[model samples]
Target: MNATTDLLRVDAVKKSYGPIQVLHGVSMSVARGEVFAIIGPNGAGKTTMFKVMTGEVASNGGTIHFDGRDVTRMPAYERVRQGFGRTFQVARVFRDFTVLDNVIVAVEARRRHTGEAVGSWRNCAPSADIRDEAMSLLADVKLDALADGAARFLSHGDKKRLEFVIALAGRPSILMLDEPTAGMSPSDRSDIAKLVSRTRKERGITVVMTEHDMDVVFGLADRIMVMNYGEVVSTGTVDEVRNDPKVREVYLGKEMVSA
Candidate 1:
């Protein structure tokens, strides 16, 4: 991909937790409208890398630029405001609120004044425009009928689906998901993958994901980056990565080589 056209770029990103260095000079670029997957064995620093990108943790060094602007020092919420949406390893939603309320809250957050949050549902009901938009998002995830149901009452898979929709609530330019399908059944995993693909296609959003399941990684990602011991070891298309001895070694790396 052309450097000029890249939407997100990470240059020599370094992070250390106390005396332990977690990410060492990691660098990669994600082009607009592509599903880029970061894959590796546990302790490979993928999540830390995700956190760094999301501004959840501070990086000791390196830079992150989005859409021609340097966002290296930007705060997490600022990053979200800059159109970077993220979901955690464990899907999170408002357990106390209804499904529709959960989405309404996120949607309001997206359009509200900067530094102002839509805190309580008690003070006001969403306008018709907000409700229409929130309900539309629920329908996108097949949760329309359950819009009034309590979020906590939904099954794990449904909760995960809701999180996906929540990420879309802001209509982000880039969506970041960490281990989206972890702990899901094969069928549920497939559902998430389809939702991801649909989102990318329909909205033309760039997707950055770190997933444990090789099936989902290989199935969803347009390009793959493999990391090990806090360093990026390889990056390529699906076929290129699958056939790479280095990636297969560190990723399926040690195991495949040992076998």
Candidate 2:
């Protein structure tokens, strides 16, 4: 695809903490509306990579381009304003805030033209339009019934859904999710996978996620990027990656036993 169609591009990105290097010259790209998955074993730097992409953690080397702008040095809030949104592996919600209010906060954050002025607790006049949009998102995530309930009261599955709504409030061109299915029940995991699939098909939002659940990755991702240690060992479709001997050796801890 052309530059105009690329939503995110990471070129030769590297990161190190003191004497230990975590990401080793990684490079990848996400198209405008594709669901991409990054799968690897534990401590493979997947979350670190997400943090670097969102500017939460600075990369020691390489470039990150979002919507054709160089954002390697941009701060996290600035990146959020630039249509790069992310959800953490751990559910982060305002425990006391109403479900709707939590999403409204994100909406306000996105509405501000100047990222510096946006505050997590800032109160903005809830315009009819904003309310409608926020409510719509809540409904989309099946949280409309609990819109007025305290965020902490929601179940774990619902909390994950709320995070998705919060991320979407930014109208992001790229949505990065860190283990969206972690700590979820089997049915809840399936629900989330279906929600992600529907979101991708209906909203055309580019999805990039790091997940350990191979079932979730295989079910939702259009493409998979497999990393071993600090380096990407394979990038391909789900079946291709599953069939790659090197990927199996690193991720599954054994060579693929042929039928």
Identify the runs in model 2 with alpha carbons over 4 angstroms from their true place: 114-125, 253-259
TM-score of each: 0.92, 0.92
Q: Which stretches of candidate 1 lie over 4 Å from their true place?
A: 1-4, 114-123, 253-259
Error of 2 at 199 (Å): 0.9
Predicted structure 1, TM vs. truth: 0.92
> How well is each residue in 1-259 modelled by candidate 1, as lDDT tens digits?
2546799999999999999999999999999999999999989999999999989988999999998888999999889888898988888999999999999988888878454445455757887777898999999889999999999999888998899888899878999999999889999999999999999999999999999988888889999999999998999998888888887766675554344
- Number of clashes in every candidate structure? 4, 0
Best by lDDT: 1
> What lDDT would each prediction earn against the true structure?
0.89, 0.87
Checking candidate 2 for backbone clashes, the offending pairs are: none
